[model samples]
Target: MTEPSTKATPTTAERIRSAFARAGGAMLAVEGLEPAESPVHHLLDDGSFAITVPVDGAVAQLVVSAGQAGVQAVLEMTDYAPLPLREPVRSLVWVRGRLRDVPASEVSALLDLIAAEDPNPALLQVNSGNGDTDRDTRYALLRLEIDSVVVADSTGAESVGLSALLGARPDPFSAMESCWLQHMESAHREVVDRLASRLPVSLRRGRVRPLGLDRYGVQLRVEGDDGDHDVRLPFARPVDDISGLSQAIRVLMGCPFLNGLRARRL
Candidate 1:
């Protein structure tokens, strides 16, 4: 199951772990599965994916476990062993068995099937020491560490973790993306909370108003009778312009209750 992320959810160590996970996902997107760019990522094949440590010392591991559809595809690809997922929801799956038996030619259908099951799941191939240099190989997998995140809700439970792939290491952009998200999770909470506190009770939705990062600053979805309104907010002042939040930044600055609030640098 996936878990929710809170203003103060995981510890510092966890943030680093989260960063590693985010990095792996980013890398897989760039290297393994470069689908037409969308809001989400996807992996497109069945192959072995491994993790490696960079000069940064911090590292993590992931396996492309199979899914229900993947189990079937593997069987079709190579006539492999008995396939059974007693309960898919409770376990992780990958394409390892199919990887060993099936050649790249037959793996495409299975990869496409898994992609259909989760169109946006991250997938990628890497160029690490253990990686295969063959330019034509591919694989499909679900990332282990990041499949869960908590939603802002009373249930206080984790969300279902999506499948992701981990291929090679990261590039400059990938590393920066990882660092950016990590920094935001660690530092942006106080800014959003303190700013949110100033708005009228009407502004806050249910007990669970998710933390949204946007172009203005931090946009809030004001749920109401018809639908929801997106209110742009500004970063807490003496602001930290770590990321571009667009118009969301301006509205928060104008909130009457938050007039005196200044963005604090982390």
Candidate 2:
């Protein structure tokens, strides 16, 4: 039987990439404009992204003022865990770049691409062509040319190059992690307890809760009076599918039988 490693598999780049893919909202700060809440932002392949702001909003106004030179901008995005674990924010991504207005002619094509990529409802509010032509035109799109990407999490802070971030992919299990972790917390408290048992005696004193999940393994948050600590319990191997995930988790729980039987059942 393969034993699980204590080491984490998701590197800084992977974590940042995954967090960017999962983030629904971001706080954007432009050189001349006040910091604005950008709930409608989409990450592109090259680490640039489209952010929608009110056409008359400060960001749009700044873009019009800055012209082709572009304005310096920094976008901050937080990655929250699926479970309501203490310190639920698993990671924060800060992207510093140059912000420029997407030309009027390209808005249609850009909107189409963003909608195809994420299909976020916020995009619907901006796409006036979707039977909402009569609705007031409120939003304008701006693009950010990423200069650097930084990620801060329990592991630590690291600056990832745009190339490295763009090269990395979100964890294969990231999409389903929420459902799986929610189920583990709500329906399988006993399983959490079993996993907690693997923690060091010192860490076991704190309240152990599911923090994050990835193809590499599960992360646990130990919350106590001292503070919160994150521990990664890696799988025997990286898992790509639900069945593989189940087997990896079972191995982490240290059940003798690895064949379909769950550790909890044993």
lDDT values for all models: 0.30, 0.78
Q: Which pairs clash in the backbone of model 2?
A: none
* Total clashing pairs for each candidate: 49, 0
Backbone clash pairs in model 2 (N, Cα, C under 3 Å; residues 3+ apart or in different chains), count: 0
Q: After superposing candidate 1 on the true structure, give the runs of residues whose Cα lies further than 4 Å from its correct spot.
A: 1-41, 44-70, 73-190, 198-247, 255-266
TM-score on alpha carbons, each prediction:
0.26, 0.89
